[model samples]
Target: MMNDCSLVVGGSKGIGLEIAKLFSERGDVTYILSRNKGKWLGNHIEADLSNERNLNHVLHYIRNNKIRFKYIVFAQKNRSLPDDLDYELMIQLKSVKILVEGIAPSMEGGAFVFIGSPSGRFIVREQPLGYHLSKAALEHLTKYYAVNLGKFGIRFNCILPGTVLKESNREFYQANEDVSNLLKRITPLRMFGEAMDIVNAVDFFSSEKSRYITGQVIFIDGGQSLEGQESLARRLTFGED
Candidate 1:
């Protein structure tokens, strides 16, 4: 029997936790994994996603409960330095691959939503190079999986969010006024996004609303990625102040 269950990795806080909360509110059997337990009143599985043994424990629980996920969200992040690229790749890539292998058999007809970043598609030299490179690789991996797993009725897509203003990171943004100005000035929307925006996108992908969509990368970046010399050229041509 197919169950209304979801597995949210790296969901203890930030965007992932918000998505998990949405799932739980809708009465879905949600499972969350992160270093710390979130404030939600649902199941929170403690596991270091980068550690094989820890992930094994999580796999065991899923197998024991016979929980088949209808939605799988990979919201994991690794903000380590360039020197720690190996650990970052392990957590953001290898771990996700392992989780998919472990649970994909039960994911027939389900949707896989990867919480990627705008860095995946565009060149971002300001941030850690490792971070940008890993996400780029992840985007390709999403396409590869989408093609291979389509036969099993599984759909894969990526949500590339940019400059999301979450409550947890309010202080960081407030302290970095220059960065905040750059984000606002570059984005066509002239504003930063909220966590709920991404959650809403995920909801659509996970439901029948997007049944025909697969192997797509949706950017929720408020048009920030649409800026650069092209934007300047357009302004010069149109004389828009």
Candidate 2:
């Protein structure tokens, strides 16, 4: 009998890394696929998803090893070229499509959770247009795969996170007291979410608890999405009511 296998794409750092850690802690045979090696308790496959050759190599390695993934997470983001449409599309959407198609055949039954952004539906001025487009498309991709792959007992879902603090942006958020406090005030939960919050949602989706759930888009934003944009903006500009 083999232990359950899990794959975390772009798991080298931040929320992705936290998700990988969760799987490893639960005794899953975890694999981290990223351009750089992550400091985590798992097998690290250093490959750039944007490179066609690297993508092929990753698929081949998984197949050759007969690794059957029970949970797959897509957390890859193109931070280097924020304004490049092609780069954003390739990392956020194309890579997910290719990897899922390649791995779905071997998966017995499991879930694929996409780490998307609230900007998928809402506009974040700080982010580029390409980022918004790619994220919006990713939501549909999740649903598309869910509908087609249901016969294989594989579930697909997307998670849209808002203002979640992680390793990469923790210092920035901690230092910016005004912005941080404003975000908390606008959120219905009155708090900023942590990386573990997203991890918990991923864990739920991958576990038997969500066995009957599929094609769902969950927002792990500490209820930030509940507030209207105008209201949020007013709060940001006027320092709350």
Candidate 3:
């Protein structure tokens, strides 16, 4: 009669926090793993993903508690040292590898959803080379784990998001009406995605509805990825056609 459990890495803020909230509301025993303690109503495991010792401590805690996860989401990112390749790799990729390998054995046929970025395939000038490289590798890593862990009934998938309106950058978008309008014009959906947009997708992947789905890369960008690069650049540089 154990309660269903879920874990959200980097669930202290932004999209991660939203995802964690969804699980908490659904009556799951949700755990938020992050460097700082989250204000949400869930079990908080303080761990810096970049630090191996911190990760080890988290693993040990979970093992000791015998927590079998029904859903595991990775929404962590390190932008403090954008140019530091090692730091970016450690936070964005290595931590995921360590946790997945360490916890997959305890999972009783659940899903692992990675929150990635469109930078995985396209170059985002604002982001560093390491960010793009780590994200690209994360997509592949999702497929790799899905293939290798299928026998164990674990599913792995990645969600690559484009421009989404979250708490972190909501003000920026609101203040820059011109930029927001331009984004709307270029995107097929003619709107920016919200945090709930991502939460819904994660919920789907975590539920039994997506039991047959795995190793898939889904984008929830309001069709922004479908826009032509040249057209977008032209719109940004000049007036829209």
TM-score of each: 0.89, 0.93, 0.94
- The residue-by-residue lDDT of candidate 3 on 1-241, one tens digit each, is 7767999998988899999999989888999998786566668988888798889988999999888898999999794788999999999999999999999998779999999999999988999999999999999999999999999999999999878998789999999999998888888888899899999999999988999999999999888887678888887678764
Strongest candidate by lDDT: 3
Model 1 per-residue lDDT tens digits across residues 1-241: 4348987898887899899998888778898878778675688878887688888888898889778788999997764445477787888888889888888887658899999877777777765766777899889988999999989989999999988898877899899998887668667888999999999999999887898899998899898777578776676478563
TM-score order, best first, reads 3, 2, 1
Off by over 4 Å in 2: 230-241
Top candidate on TM-score is: 3
lDDT of 2: 0.88
Better of 1 and 3 by lDDT: 3
**CA error at residue 44 for candidate 1, angstroms:** 1.5
Q: What is the C-alpha RMSD of each candidate to the true structure, in Å?
A: 2.6, 2.0, 1.9
| Candidate 2 clash pair list | none
Candidate 3 Cα deviation (angstroms), residue 226: 1.4
lDDT for model 3: 0.91
Give the C-alpha miss distance for residue 61 in model 3, angstroms: 1.1
